[model samples]
Target: MEMFRGFLFISIAMILFSLNLSNVEGRIHYHKKQKKGSPVEPPTYAPSPDDPVSQSPSYPPPVSQSPSYPPPVSQSPNDPPAVPSNPSDPGNTTSEDCVFDVMAFGAVGDGCTDDSAAFAAAWKEACAVESGVVWAPSNLTFLITSTIFSGPCKPGLVFQVDGVLMPPNGPDNWPKTDSKKQWLVFYRLDDMTLTGSGTIEGNGDQWWELPCKPHRGPNGSTKPGPCDSPAMIRFFMSSNLVVSGLRIQNSPMFHMKFDGCEGVLIEKLSISSPKLSPNTDGIHIENTKSVGIYDSVIANGDDCISIGPGCSNVNIEGVTCGPSHGISIGSLGVHNSQACVSNVTVRNAIIKNSDNGVRIKTWQGGAGSVTGISFENVQMDNVRNCVIIDQYYCSTKACQNETSGVYVTDVSYKNIKGTYDVRNPPIHFACSDTVPCTNITMSEVELLPEEGELVDDPFCWNAYGIQETVTIPPIDCLQDGGPEAIGESGTYGCY
Candidate 1:
């Protein structure tokens, strides 16, 4: 037929060119085995999403999983549990239907039922849930009174409070128009977070047995009229705040007040009262700013962290304070008033059995200025005036020495090791014949004498600074800044 139809078209064109070269060598051996299994080796440490430990540090990832209680006990077993310097800190994060369950808003945990209208209707539905959480469940004991949970909330709200909250059993059930001065306020809030592991209990004996309670009058005297007791948690004009792991005890007067706050973060708190429990004061800051009192434990009756009068950038750490009145920054500008504290910082503290250890009282004529203060790594046991700076602060002993004080400057005392209760003077520093406390600095101060009595000699006046590494009973009464020798025209004379 035409050479057998051209041999069937040359055997079908050599079997279609050998099946197109075996499908092009099987797609070039499947792209050379996917280019030799290319994953491209690019991971060495690769974790930075803001790195809260790129892979494992557990992180602030343990507010629960089993926390039915047990962890607040920290009186410095070397204080190792204060996390949150931003382990994803959104004021200490929380979520899940925005958690608002104070016994589901009927709130009768039963410690005598007054739950303040179910905690003001669960803080008005957790101030409208944005990250809200009003939950207070664990062992349960509610009982509030003299409330006021007002707020401009919904920005990470969280008043967890796991248990007891008692108040209102003293001052004859207190209602005489309620302003006993505070009792759990929290007005005008912002990113708030009053944490858990609860217990508020301010049933302050009968407002500490009234008569204006300075131990009920008689020589530690007080007999004034209203004298308003009560301040067991105040926080007015708040900002991104956080008062953590609370356990605040008997109060009737100052035990956690922070007014006009801003970025506060009092952590791991556990304030108690009665050392004679008079003015209470265990964590009070006024007109606060960038505050951060961390890892706390204050025993109490005034000043276990009180830095009042327009405080600025305050920061205390690993606290563990004492049987009262030790970490104060003021009696500041009282009444002659016009204070202005600045950048205060206390660090790694532990002032046991204290009456005074790192104080800085001011009162005489009171004008402005207490600048950049710092007391570092302090640790005193039998403490009683182990580093003071009075400025003639008189609360009695018939006052009167006014001259225009309060200008302590750049104060610093670092690594203050110690045990001192030789009565007083382990470093006194009177200052202010007219504001004469300038640039004082001490380093590695070691104050011994727990009762082996012999360490006194350190009582400067019109203080003036600089001792770098030899200060146990040897500060030699710091002086040397002149205006004629000390102040007011000098020669040192303000007793």
Candidate 2:
């Protein structure tokens, strides 16, 4: 009987796989374990016509010697619709400057001596009360340090920035690495909203020495990168945080890093940094869950959004990028860490003039599993590397690539449309050569790539397609950026 049950399970799974149904498109269904006497409703799947597998369940060849079993339902009279939880917090209401009924913040834009004292005063006041608007009015360069973000995480606690929260300039402008204080940050805050038509500038040049780290230490640098200004907004180990409709730019490191937090909503935010800046990931999230990032614009040299280790149950949708590295997961398993990223979805995103469009990059020889990840309805233009799934992406100095072996599994991409203009290799699906990637699937993904000159990938003809295949054009990454003329203006940059 046990052998028979194993056979039955394998048969069902095999039939589902053969039909080429993506996890996103409801092409596959399996029975989940249920309690005795409990009701069981089989999932509905949309199977492919080209597939020989059953669209509907078919009966097994009869057990001629035994009593007959009941057939599964053909249709149900009534069933509750399934609801996929989105990361967006719709309850976060929109508010305009001055019209807001919350605590007013930051010395009303005097443009004189640093407004840190004023900002400190207002923020402290807002915290003292249960709820209020904390405003950064126009023209104010609010300088702040080690401001504790103790919030009720409620709408009553509103943070409005109508002006600039600028970081101090020169070396003195650096966030005190001695302690994680210097710039404005939020920790253990909840149900709080940061909304305004203003800017958060960190005078970052003072710490230029950090980025050129010739040494190594904790947090990825012994000598921290100059880009490591205290975080723009650090919602550490907190949840239900909402940041909407604000321009959060010029951070030392991450524009906003929500670490180990849940129920985070970042909407209509313009998170920016200089394109040449290093380690300035627009948003870096790690060890968190239930987060939504939508309707936002991010321009940076690093990952627009870096979904780091131990992240699960995340939804990233409807975002646009500029001069970014696109969205990514992993670079995990650093410093002997066992990280797992799972149950996340990214959809309806546009990436322009970026290095890589959408990717999952893992430390080639780490111990972690990246599973059940979905990318849907992605549109790309002028992208350098349209798609990548690198399992052997090693960056750490201690890595012995020839010895350490890691693998990636169960990743899906659906309905991706893009054009790669640069001449480099657009798609590098170099999964772990040893422990090969398993159950990796793509559907309805197309890439039209062209550089200054034509270059093609012979192996690319066989990629994902729901209705059709992923398309790719040819261009030379090396030749595309060359000078058009040999004289004055033509003597431009070199490779």
Q: TM-score for each prediction?
A: 0.32, 0.67
**Candidate 2 lDDT score at position 133:** 52
lDDT of 1 at 200: 85
* Per-residue C-alpha lDDT of model 1 across residues 79-121, encoded as one tens digit per residue: 2233223111322334444555655556667788777786787
TM-score of model 1 (CA atoms): 0.32
468-495, model 2: which lDDT tens digit per residue?
Answer: 2444432112121212222211111211
Q: Please list the C-alpha lDDT of all candidates, in the order they appear.
A: 0.73, 0.58
Per candidate, the number of residue pairs that clash is 2, 25
Among these predicted structures, which one has the highest lDDT? 1
Q: Which stretches of candidate 2 lie over 4 Å from their true place?
A: 1-108, 151-155, 175-182, 208-228, 396-398, 402-407, 452-455, 458-495
